[model samples]
Target: MYFSQNAIILVMLMFVVSAVFYSTINYQTKAVEDEIKIKEVSIYEKNVKNTIDRNINKIVEDAFVNASYKIMKSRKFFPNAKVAVNYITSFIKNETNKSLKCIVGNSSNITFDVGSFDIEPTDDPLKIRVIGNIELRYTERLNNGEIVGLKNIQIDKEVKLSRIPDPYVYLNKFYYKWEYGRKIILNNFPNDDKNHTFCIILNDSNFNYNRMYNENSPTEIRIIGRNSSTGRWNVVLPYWVQTWREGNNHVSIIWVKVNNKELLNVSEDYIYLLYNSTTPVDREDPENTFILFDNFDYFDPDKWNESGEILINNSKLTVVAGAGSSVFSKDTYGEGYELMFRANFSYTPENNSESAGLFNKLDDTGGYGWAYYGDGDFEIVMGDDSYGIDNTFDYINKTYIYDLILNNISNHPYIEYNIYDSTLNLEYSKRETGSFDGTYPISINALPPENKTSNTNITVDWIFLKDVNNITATVGAENIQPITYTEEKPKTFNGVIYYGVGAYDKVYNGTYSIIGLFTNKSDYWKYPTTVGYKPLIEEN
Candidate 1:
């Protein structure tokens, strides 16, 4: 409004100020607009990136799931394909987010199916399945601070479940009892379930179902809840008979029996006391209460050791023929006794014509004599050493020989026991006296060396020799001479000695009947047949 000389200059300056203000405002507005545009681009780019990532995740998950399904179904991971795919999807699937299928696809591609077996298509585990308890357990803890275990588990619905027999071993009635031998203590098992086990007894077995049982011989046994994440429910079956083995187990002892022959003497201490018609038929001597022992039938262990505590040890019976010195408990009777000692064979001389049984004439205390009883006949004569006996006492001059039935008993070849019937029959042979030096406590008249052949099997049977001074040739846990019997007369065991007939094979050592019967002139046993299983006395 002022128009002086100063006013003119002020006015010009005001005009210039106005123009500069206008330019400044315009540039500021443009710059603000550009910043807004840049912000919009940034927002758009972020949205695009997020969408891409989400889509990628979805694809991966779907692929993972599809691959998992194929793997499970085709391989029949579960009982069948139905269970396989269903199980995998249940863990990895998301219905509301079907787009999330790629998660499973990715997971499947990462995992490996190892040790898989053949597949079946028809089975459906869930159709009649029982879902198992979600047992959260420690499967494994990797060093990388990761814990893995079974999850979402379910017990199959169709699995058959049954109770197992009480794994208890007591004094079996027919094996060892108060009246027969002694009350024995057997091990009891399957009684402790602290480990948590569920059993499924199978009513169907390949063998006779009626004979197959628990420790008591149940008809079946199977698995239950075996899919446990822990080791509690899974187990491998065992091979057991009526025998109690030591730490080595029943299976190991079977092999020992096959290798050794001299195991006969040591076998009775800890026997395989069992009865199975299929493979094993060893039972305890059941019948008792008699002094004569006419019947060896036994069942329960309590009947034998009515007062004593009998323990069954399953230690392996490894008896070698030459484990010890051939001359056990024998002292040389000066220089003469030295001549009687021979490893393989020995020579004996004859003495009196009739007074002696064609052997040397030694005094009652000097000569070795045996108490023989057969066909109700009784006599005394010199003991002969021809069988596998090691004549370590060859230094003692053994005179005249008394022969006993040294072959198999009719059909059983594995059994060549000394028959007492004809053993000390002094009248039949060329009697002799004053031969044996009595260095050995027990008179061992072994079979001749020439007679011993791998073809000839040897069996050892035992009985109470029925005399204060009489003892069976073989000594075992179950076989002992009765020092004092409630009733006077002792028990006698009449084992036979015969060989196998050459009709079937050259050597006969035991009973050879596929069907289980008694008929034939063969006095020995043959291959592939269970012999020495029964006593010489038949049970009527």
Candidate 2:
């Protein structure tokens, strides 16, 4: 019985040992399985989070790029609108690597100044405090707040966005609220201001300027253009907007450039002469020999229209054959007719050697085939049948320049002088080469002037000469007799008078002194330093 009991005990002990070992192995395997599952779940969650972050970053980068483009290169064309918004949104949602987000809308409650806003008058723009509401929209939130995806993951960063402020609802009122599709520039352009007080009207290209101005300075108008058939520019009352056309190139104010560089009229684009304006304030009456021509009655040898013979002045008129008298047309055949006066001369001499009858089938050059008589640079006038021999003299009508036709006679000479004092000297020349005739050229010099030009004020054009009697300075004034030459030369003549310096801008008045002598049809002018003095203007 003792042996049987021992055996049972031993078997029981083995069973307990085996049971403990199996339980230990099973527990280890279960623990290992749980650790493997935990690791796998952790990896999956990490991957998903990283992907979401990357996508967000990519969107932000795209939005930033679009916003940047708008501010830099595309604002002028597609400023703000659907296109811009779509561009920003698309970039934010589709861009890779960088995460971005953006929104666009308007806020009427926002207020901004002028310069910053691209505003037009149609907006009913308010002035002063420029009251309005502005809308703020999200534009971009870049990846990691970094420029591109080249860098390591960046942390959360705030993105910059545009905001609109309100101005109208009292200084402290919160009535100014922003919403989408509404934008108000509150002091937008900080330093800019909108001014539309005074109005400037521009005339149309087809407008008329005939009654624009009448001898008076335009008061109410700022500027004006003159009426011309073509290429005409004038200053008249009220500005002309005629130069501008609808949908044409941009127009300009102040000055018009001829070829895009050469500045033309300062105000008006054209200027015309008032041919029939009142006679000058100064000048002697004509002998009433001129007859006005109705048509452009311009022809050679028909100069009676522009001029006539004066029979009864103090002296008769005469000319030397060698001297050149430039006449538009002469009535040698008794048919007088002529055109408007530019300038010219006429003469009849007592001596045949000093005079020659001029006849031209056609018009001739200025210094060619002409007759002349008078003092230096003598301008001619008209009357009738006063050519006297022995007592015959070349009579000059007492008159002044700038007088509308001295007489109705359009037959007189017309000399539209084109001269220049280029060398700062008195030397001047007129060559027949300007026309078909290359012969017969002349050079007249500026005589020594006693009086110099004045810089203190506007220049005065007239000066009274001494001893120049019957020389009316104006409508009613008698001139003193001019100094006479003691001796007359047959083939020589001297021009110009010398006297004491008078007030600046006026003709010198005093005793005659220095003189210049030259042969008829001569090419050179003598400025004798011994007595001839050349006057020069004061340097600016």
Clashes of 2: 99
Q: In model 2, where do residues sit more than 4 Å from their true spots? A: 1-20, 44-55, 63-540
lDDT of 1 by residue, 319-395 (tens): 11121111111222211211111111122222111111112221122233332111112233434432222222321
Top lDDT: which candidate number?
1
Ten contiguous residues minimizing lDDT sum, candidate 2? 465-474
Off by over 4 Å in 1: 1-276, 281-326, 330-440, 443-540
lDDT of each: 0.24, 0.23
Candidate 1 overall lDDT versus native: 0.24
Q: Which candidate comes out best when scored by TM-score?
A: 2
